[model samples]
Target: MTSELSWLRRRADKRAEIGPWELREGLRSRSSELRALLEERKLEHPQGTPEGNRVHRFADEALSELENAERALTHAHQRYKVGSHVAVGQIHIDTAHNLLLRLSRPSEIVSMMPGILAIVQSRLSSDDPRRARVEAIAQSPESIGEPERETILDAVGVARQASIRENLRVRSFVNIVGWVAGCLAVAAVLVALMGAVFEDMVPLCFTPYRGLEVGGYVVVCPVAMNPDPKGGRDINESEASATTPADYLVIEIVGLVAAGIAAATTLRRIRGAVTPYNVPVVLALLKLPTGALTAVLGLLLMRGSFIPGLSALDSSAQIIAWATILGYSQQLFTRFVDTQAQSVLNAVSAPNAMPPPPSPPQGATSSAS
Candidate 1:
């Protein structure tokens, strides 16, 4: 206990150099309270009953978990850096967050009685003495004996497990999102590199019927120079010089810019929560490379005359405008992802309420009647 208190004091002294101010302050406050609780427990005489021993053991284990949580937070703060380190730090912080949440739950369990009672009411028949006892205890918590307390603790344990599972699911989803974003980013870079290296081989140029007349044929490329309009050569021959790596690069940049705007619009959907995971940031990143890829593909589709009535683009400004539109159009695909992410966030942010009871079978209700 003394060592733990000393560690807390030391961390408090270095508060400015640690994690976020809010987290640091919250941990400091909680640690002080936990230390006092442990001290009080230490002062209690050893009990002979199995339940008393079990409760004491649980308290000891809780203290150990709290210490581990503190260490995780400290490690996360110390290892904080950019790139992959950011992910590692976030994982550590999340671990600490979960542990702290579980450790602090017992105190909040009293307030959770309504939900617990709901669970008990649903599972146990109305006339069951144990169910009645639970309800009575709920009405007057001071009347709880060891057996009643044990039953309440059992319910709380089940709820805690569910909460833990939900947190794990959220973490798994965030990790998957981060991986996908990374892959898309890599793919975008590769595409850009391919565009740069094989510029003429895979040109983004198009031959519009109404383009600048070259040898009586319309030739259009994204470059400033169009093959001499009066050279009297085929339109295909002029396309090579007009299209360069810069065309694809510029379109990609425009697409990225448009995607960024779209990403910003999603910020309004984010809810404030105490979680260490940054789902919004990951979701935003997922949009960026997707936008860039879509922009390039959209323009390519147009260049190939795939979209009737909008096949031919006459000017550089027109192509850029189209790129911007395509970039923003990434939302059409990412909207589903946004919806899913929102649902996940909502699940995590939901109050620690009990799940609704299952409805009775239609046949069973009719039979009872």
Candidate 2:
């Protein structure tokens, strides 16, 4: 019954929408046991077992399991991919500690950060045997008591609160997205319904019957809007009003906003590995389809016509133009998001798998400070 972050829960919901990662293959049972041990600390000595002997054996097994779990995570590239729409995978913090496999809390990234940090630190000091040095260091025990532990835990609680606040920001953006979509939908319905009711040939000097014919082409009181509202700069209002044919409008708005947010988020994630940006970027990207659709709606409205007439507006040319517009819009947004995401990812990657920069020559103060 391990409690997990709510964002992790939300992320899990997006996996199928993205795609599955094959990183979770094999070693499920081992992962389960490790999770239990980490949670319960249940590897105490049995009645006859020697305390030191039993603890040492347990530590060895734990280390081995940790190695295996870490290897699985790395090979799967899941830490990075978990956030990707393409990495459809499930994580159970209680039973699997899977969400930690995503790059949420750095301290909790046991297989990746803490272990690697410790190992790299150990390998650096080329003094005695590396194994001997690490073993001696590991043997050193801390002198913390209950009060200190409590204080540390309390600090952790505060940090977790910050994470909760970040999560709320994400939820807020979700609300914004839904609201934008809802507004477009409602406006379209309202305006269309109003127009349907008011079309008694009153606003027009002539109806479809009065439309004039010039040579092979016909142009008249076609009721097709006054000089085409959406076709020109002056008609932007008509194209952008809440009342536009909103399917495309909503999707397009969503796509532009989402793609933009995703691009920014991807960059932030890779560069600073700004953990807080994850939710916002994701929420924004989730809104992309809406943006794309909204833009499409604007195009449709630009090629304006009455409801009965719009059916005729559905020519192969119109359809192709619209499809091309929407498709290209989606692609443009995707490119930006991908580029930024990769940039951020590149930065977050092991900045240096090599040893730490050499300390200022013996007691010398370094300029790095």
Compared with the true structure, all predictions reach lDDT values of 0.66, 0.38
Reference-based lDDT, residue 310, model 2: 42
Q: Which of the numbered candidates is closest to the native, going by highest lDDT? A: 1
Candidate 1 vs. true structure, TM-score: 0.73
For each candidate in turn, the TM-score is: 0.73, 0.32
RMSD of every candidate to native, in Å, equals 7.6, 14.3
| Candidate 2, run of 10 with poorest lDDT | 201-210
Tens-place lDDT per residue, model 1, 26-117, is: 66566556656654554462557764565466556656655654554554445342123223333333333333333333445566577768
Cα misplacement distance, residue 146 of candidate 1 (Å): 2.1
* Model 2 regions more than 4 Å off: 1-35, 38-40, 43-148, 200-369
Candidate of highest TM-score: 1
Worst 10 residues of 1 by lDDT: 81-90
| Model 1: how far residue 20 lies from native, Å | 5.4
